[model samples]
Target: MDKIIESFIEDFKTEFNYEKIDKSKLFEHYVNYVLISKIYPDRSSLDKINVGGTRNPGIDGLAIMTNNHLVTSQEEVDYFIQDADLLDVEFNFIQSKTSESFDMGDIMTFIASVKEFYKDGELLFEDDLLNLRDLKNYIYKNSIKMEKSPSLKLYYATTGKWLGDINLTTIINSGIQDLKSLDLFSDVKFIPVDGDKLKSLYREIKNKITKEIIFEKHTILPKMDKVTESYLGILPVTELVKVTSDDDGELIKTIFYDNVRDFQGFNKVNTGIKTTIERKNANDKFVLLNNGITIVAKTLNKVGSAFKISEFQIVNGCQTSHVLHHMKTSLEPSIFVPLKLIVTTDDDTINDIIRATNSQTEVKNEAFEILKPFHKKLEEFYLTFEKDVNKRLYYERRSRQYFGAKAKSEKIIGLSTQIASYIAMFLNEPQSTQRYFGELLNSYSNRLFLDNHSLFPYYTSGLAINVIEELFRENKLNYTSKKFKYHLLLMFRIQVAGAKVPINISGNKDNEKYCTKIMEALWDRENALKIFKSLELKLESVLAETKVLNRQAYLTRAFTEELLPTISNAKKEGKLIYYNFQKGFGFIKVNNSEDETFVHYTELSKVKINEIVPGLELLFDIFQSPKGAQAKNIEKKDIVKKSI
Candidate 1:
C-alpha cells in the first residue's frame, strides 16, 4: 500500500472506529466515505450507504438519493412520496479495489452486476442491496412523482492511477451503452477514481475550499459589529455556477446550508427562476426578480477585480443556485445573479445572517436551530469535558466546526446526531430517531434543547452514543443490533440508572446525579462493553420472538413497548452460592429461589479471580448459552462477602 493511502486508512479507521473490521475491507469503506462525503459532507450516517457485505454481487456500496437526501429504507421513499410532488432521485454505485491496479475482469464484473441489478429476473444479493433494490422499485412505482428519469452514477475506485487508456475507456463506454439501453435512467456515467483523485477527495473533506471569482460590479454594505466586510453585487450566472460546482462541474452540496431545507426539486419558486432565465432578453433582469445568493466567507481577499473567498457557504440561495446550475448550459453570458457576500469568522454573526436571510423563504425553522441559545450553551458544555478523554465529545453546532481540529470524527457529535442520541437515551424515543429531521424537530422541539434543560444528560447521551457506535464497529455487539442502537442506548441507560425519567432541567441536582450514574458506567470501558453485550442478547431475544423488526415496528411505539420489558427484566439479582477461585467458575443462587445459575470470572468487571466469594449478592443478567442459563455482566453490588 502507498504510505499516503495507509495513513488515510488509519485516519478512516479512527474516524469511523473500524479497527475491528477486516483490513482488506477497510479500503471499500475508505472509498465510500471519501466519495460520499464529496457529495454530502455533513451526512451523519455513512453506514446506511454501505452494502459491502457477504454476497454483495461485485458492488462495494450503494446510495439511493431522493431530492439529495440519502434514502436507505423504503420508509424514507414513502416519506418523499407523501412530502413532495416531484422527486429528483439518483442511484450511485461504487466498487473499490485495494490492489495497486484495476483489472479488466473486475471492471466488467462490476458493470455486469449493475446491469443485473436493474433486471426483472431474480438474483441473490446481500440483504442491504436487496433493500436498496426494493427502494429503487418503490421510487419507480411512483414515477409520476419523479421530476425526470432517475440518474445512474457508477464509481470504480482503485489505488492505481487512471492514465485514461483508450482500451479501458472504450470498454467502460461500451458497458455504459448497454446500461443506457435499459432506458431506466436519464443519464448513465461511470467515474473512474484513481489514487491521486482519491487523495484529493480525502483532502477536500478536511480542507477549507477556496474559489476566486470576478467581482467587478459591487456596492459595499454598511459595516456592523462582528461583520468584517459585506458587499452586495451582481455576478454573472456563469461565475455563480463556478462557485456552486466542483472541478467535475458537479454541484457542491456541502457548501450550502447544513439543514433540512435542501434544494427542493423544481418547485414553483425554482420553476419561476428557471423560466426567467430561459426568457429571451429576460436574463439581464434576473438580478432584479430573484432573491440573490448570499455568500458567507470566513476570509476574503481582493486582488484587482477578482475576489478569492475561502470557507464560504451559500446561506440563503439554495433554490436559486440549484436552478441556475441546472440551467447553466442555456444561460446567456449576459445573465446576472444578485449576490450578497459577507466575510466573517464569527459564528453568531453567520448564524444571524443565515436566520435573517432565510426568514422570508420557505425554509424550515430547524434550519436556524444552531442559532438557538440552548445549542450555544450545549456547545460550551461539551467543552467542559474536553480534558477528560472518557467523557469528551466535541459538539458541532455548525457544519465542520471541528474540522482540522485534533478531535476524532467519531467523538465529534453533530447537531442531528446529538438530537437523535439525546432523544433515544434520555427522552425514550429510540423508535422515532429514524424519522425525518423536520418531523422530529416539529414534534420534539419543545421537549429538547429547552432553555432550562440540564446539559449533563445531553453530554451523557452524546458520549454514550459514541461508545455504542464504537462497540458496534468493533463487533463487540451483534451486527444486527446496529439498527437498534438507539434502543440499546435507552436500555443501557435503564440498566445503569433504572427506567425512571430524570428531571433534566437546569438547577435540578437529581438530573446531574442521574446522568452521572450513566456516565460512570460508560466511562469504565469494560463495564460499558459488558452492559452492551448483555443488552444485545436481550434485544436479539425480543426481536426474535416478536419478529417485528421492520419499518412499521420502528415507526410505531408498540415495538418499543414490547422491547422495554425485556431490558427491564434484564436485571436479575442472585446470591453467589458456590465458586472455584482456582478455575474461575461458579453458580449463583437466584434471589428467593433454590435454582442456581452459572457464573464465570469472564463476566465480572469489578472483580478478579480471588475476589469471588460465596453469598456475595450479585447484580447480573442471564444469557442462555449452549451450556445453560449463565449469569453475564455480573456487577458486584452490595457484596455481603460471606464465607462459604
Candidate 2:
C-alpha cells in the first residue's frame, strides 16, 4: 500500500470520527477524489454528500469522463462520434462497503440495484437518492433520446476481497447479460474493482504510471550527444503494437501522457501505412520510404536480443503503428521498422524531441497556427461575444500566447488549433477523421481543413466543454468512467447529428455548415437528446444489419471483430461490401434492400493487386459487362486519391 493512500484513509477516518457525517460518505469521497486527481487529469467528481443522501440513486459519486477523445464504437449510435462529443458523463452507482470483507449476497445486492435502475429508468429516480431526480428529468426531457435506453455502468468498489470463492468476473458478466435480457440499457459494462485493484488505484493517485525501461545493450545505438541517452534500433511490428496498444487502451494512453494528444481519427496517412505494410515489396524498400519511429522511455536495457521497456511513447510513427496494428491480418512476421528511442526523464527534452522529430522529418509537421480559419472566425465571434462576460469563449491558435490570458482573462481557455482541427475533422466524418487524423501537420492533413466546413475554434472549444459541463451539471447522464468516457462522446455525436438533417451536413452542400444545431440547443439546454432518440427503431434496424465498425473501434480490433462490420457504413456507401479473393469477386449488399452485385478483381485497379485480398474494403462504379451489372473502376478505400 502507498503511504499517501494510507495517510488519506487515516485522515478520512479521523475526519468522520470527529464529525457526525456518515463514514460511508467519507469513504466514497476518498475514492472519488483519488479517481479524479489520479486517473483523470483536469477533472473532478461530485461527492455523494455534496449531491444526495440515502436517495442518491444507488450512485455514490458523479464523474465527468473528460479525457475520452475517440474510443470504441461498441454501443450503437445514431451518428458518428466527434471530438467534442467524446466526453461522456457517467454515474458511479457505488456499492462501497468499506468493511474488512464482502460476500456474494452483497455483490447480488449491488447487482439488484443496477437491475432496478434499468427496470425503472428515470421514473425510479423520482423518489431515488443522490440528486438523480434531476438526471431523470434530463433523460426524458428529450423524448427522442429517451427512446433508446441510457447506457449504465455498474461499479462495485470495496476495501476488502470477496469472502465467497465464487468467480466475480463470471458473475459480473452474467449479471450484465441478465440486464441486457431485461433491455434495461442500450449497453452495460460491469466492472468489479476488487480490493487489490482499488488499492492499486489509490496508490497510483499519488505516483503516476512512470517506470524505468531497459533495452538489450547490443540493440541500443550509442548516444550522439551527452545531453541525453538516445538509442536507435529495430523491433518486430508485434512488439511495437503490443507495447503501444494495450487490450483496453489505458496502458498505451499512459505511455503518451505528456503528448496531450490522442490518435487523430483514422485517415489515409494511417491507411497508407496499412497499404505500405501489406504491399509485396515492403521489406526491400520500406526502410528507405518510411521514416522510423521516435520514442521516449524512462530507462533502457539491452541484454543480448532481449529488450524490455518499463514505459515508452511514440512521438512520431503513430500512423505507422496504428495501421500496422489494424492491418495485422496482412502483416509479415519478420518485417521491422527502424526505431529511435530516447531514454530521458527531462520533460523539456521530451518535448524537444517531439518537436524536432515531427518538424525535421521528411513530412514536416506544421504548427496549430495553421488553424487560422478557425482562429479568425473565433476572434470575430468573440468581438460580439465579449459583451456577454459570462458567455465569452477565447480561441488560442498558439499555445499559451493569448494576450488576453496574459491579462488574466476570466473566460480564457487555451484552444490549440491542432486540437481544433481534431475536433472539427472528427465531428465532420469519423471515417475520414480516422483515415487522416494522425497526419495533421502533413500536406495530406489539409483534407481536414478544406473550405467545406469553416473552422469555429470557439465552437470547437465551447461546444464540447459547455455540453459536457451541462450534461454533468444537470444530471442528464447515466454513468461516467475514465475507461468509458468514449461512450458519452458517442451519445453526444448523435445529438449533434440530430440537429441538422444528416444529408445537408454532407459535402453535397457547396459550403458546408459546421454543426451548430447541437451547440445552439446545448447552449439553451433544450431538447437536445431527442435527436438520436426518435431514430431508435430505425437505427436499431440499421445497426442490426450494419457491417462496418466506425474508426474508433480500430484500436481494439480483436474485440471489435466480435462486433463485426466495425466502422462506418457511410464510406462503404455504394462500393463492394464484401469480397471473396478465391473467386476473384465479391458482393455489395446495398443497405435496406436485399440487392447484391458482383465484382471481380480484374475490374479494379491492378496497383494494389497483391493487396487486393478478401475483406479489403473498396469503392467502385458499376459498368456494363456481359455478366450483368459489373463492378468497375474499383478502388481500395484506404488508398489516397491522386490528382487527375
Highest lDDT model number: 1
lDDT of 2: 0.47
Tell me the tens digit of each residue's lDDT in model 1 across 1-644. Answer: 77898898898888767889987688998899999887767547588777886677579989888878787665567666766667888899999998888788889989999998898867688766776786788889988888689999999999998888888888999999999999999999999999998988888776799999998899899988998998998999899998989887888888985433688888888789888887877877888998788899999999877999999999888888888899888887688888999999899888888888887866666666778888889989999988988778899988888777888888888877888898888778887787666556767877888888889998999999899888888888877667788988988998888765656779888889998999999999899999999988887777777756453455456677667757756467888889887887889998876667888777776765566778777887664332456776677765533421
Provide the lowest-lDDT 10-residue window in model 1.
635-644
Tell me the tens digit of each residue's lDDT in model 2 across 396-419. Answer: 433222431322222344443234
Q: Which ranges of candidate 2 are over 4 A from the true structure?
A: 1-23, 33-53, 62-94, 103-106, 112-153, 167-174, 182-188, 208-226, 241-252, 264-292, 298-313, 317-335, 358-644
Q: How close is candidate 2 to the true structure, as a TM-score?
A: 0.43
